[model samples]
Target: MGGKTVASLRNRADLLKFDYTHLYGKGHRRPVIAAVTDERLRELVLQSRSWNHLAQGLGYAASNTKDTGWRPRVEARINALGLSTEHFQGRGFNGLAPLAHEPVFTADPTPERLRVAATGKAIAWFSERGYTVSLPVEPAVYDLIVDSPNGLDRIQVKSSAAADRGVHCSRTLYDTTRPGSASTGRYTRRPYEPGEIDYFFIVMADGGMYLLPYEVIGRSMKITVGARYEQFRV
Candidate 1:
């Protein structure tokens, strides 16, 4: 009584007055705050379809100008947590989809889409086989670098749907100053040289896969996957 003043007594009374849950014998209320752990952030990233989707999950309004810095902050946090932001960027989420169970294409996809799909399949294939796969930070001749028990192998992936009873793989890189015109504009096709890449990972329309050495495939402009290459099927 000597130590407790009027203010203290009033505060205690207020606390008791608000403690109806305890008096009613109802259980304690659930925690209002949840810790944002690295695992939770990674789960959100995986579930997010795009950057804006991720930002919204983190409590930032999509159209709010004040939230403009959220992306950089989130990227920094992801890096601090030892996570890669690649999954939050282009075509990364596509790899997370059920590519194996996807329906057959009714029409041909754009070259870029096809490339992304093929790369996703290649990544899954290597990952399932217990090999460590990584992408180049900068543009390189090879699409993937695979760390195998034998050694590191540079893999260039090529994909083609079955056409006229065969899978056609382009073995050359082309550049055109003017697209859609063969005449009056510079058009060049450069074939893959020896020692450029160790292997060619070919994905066919029917889900058939093959890994062939560059030496065996040579400088051919187009290599058709047929009965002869069946030995290389993986």
Candidate 2:
């Protein structure tokens, strides 16, 4: 969002730009919100074009600051994630779906059900710290592989949902069908660099979980619920 672009709903101060969406703690330049992560806002709410331009094209607002009730807490988090801001009218991907004028369908909990609730809260947070974790029916890079009592490593289960105080996740996605691109699939939030894994059992949005490690994560991190990393609480 360095280009600083946000144009569309221009009125009540652009509906006060989603009450400064939330999430801050590392380099505070201001950009309401882009992705704190509920699977990168469900892959940018299915490539938003409506939903009033998905929080300013996933960069929230670019200044001129405004925050008032944040549209009933982001429509109570899009009706508690059941979603429906009522926009579309159809025209073959005109803003990309969501306007059939019906509930459509939902039971919530997707993205592999919050990635199996962040791999069952990081395997009950390392079996309550006593350690002895193992779950790899098919993990190749890293998901969970601890045999620690002080040994084996590799653990990466990050999760995110809360956005007002911080917690929106996204490793990648925004292919846009590639081939000459521009169709817009947008959603490139990042983090996790060093060798890709050594420990990072996040999972926030209130159910709280930490356990970070891997050089205190520095790929432009912003996570901040109980800052100080709460001694890597589980």
Candidate 3:
């Protein structure tokens, strides 16, 4: 495929995957959910309370067939076809509901999952306001590149679910794993430099979002998203 086509396909896949998790909740069932295309089959899968129940309804032999086997095959088929599962719910094939003001996050999610949830919310937030959002093909300083009316803006997403007095957003990147980085094995804190990112999109513990320009909060190692920052809240 051409470069633009590949990127377009990737962007669509990412959006669909995010929508699915946002609607159905994240779990291993994604492939199976995406693979089953028939409305009747989808209804059966969603309405049925359990996987075993779904298997039985599909006419798999309860004695001979392992319920676990079916899901992988369905996922494999979808992968082979290069198609995402269509969301069958009333919302649409994407299964997206109106974006909630605050996205729901799981209890005590790991740092990586938290980052992903925040980024997903950021993408939806910008997209809802009529901007085109794209993810970088390789790792970069910014999390998302948004094509807005003004121009393309690079967005760095930060999230904090832990709060004492306020949500704490770290402005520096840490690389503790690098060998000989420091005596404490911690890399020096490096704040984002000028022109590195156009904006900082923060997701707070309460699900409050803030989109602030880089110039407004420059070179701070840590920013507390509290009352003082209320004006930037989105």
Q: For residues 52-147, what per-residue lDDT tens digits would candidate 1 score against the true structure?
A: 666556554445424455466667777787765564555333323335565776777554366569988999999999999999999888899999
**TM-score for model 3?**
0.48
lDDT of each: 0.68, 0.60, 0.67
Q: Kindly list the per-residue Cα lDDT of model 3 for residues 1-234, writing each as its tens digit.
A: 476885686589797774322122213344535545665464565554344455554544455335466667654654565544443333212322356587666468554466569999999998899899999999898999999877999999988766553434345455777777465566556778898899999987566899999887776767777888889999
Rank candidates by TM-score, best first. Answer: 3, 1, 2
Which residue segments of model 2 deviate by more than 4 Å? 1-100, 109-138, 144-154, 158-197, 214-229
Q: Residue 195 of model 1: what lDDT? A: 83
**How many collisions per candidate?**
0, 6, 1
RMSD to the true structure for each prediction, in A, is: 17.0, 26.2, 21.5
lDDT of 3: 0.67
* Model 1, TM vs. native: 0.47
Off by over 4 Å in 3: 1-113, 165-186
Q: On residues 193-231, what C-alpha lDDT tens digit does candidate 2 reach at each position?
A: 767677777876567778777677656466664657788
TM-score for all models, in order of appearance: 0.47, 0.21, 0.48
Assess the local accuracy of residue 58 in candidate 3 as a C-alpha lDDT between 0 and 100: 52
Query: By lDDT, is 2 or 3 better?
Result: 3
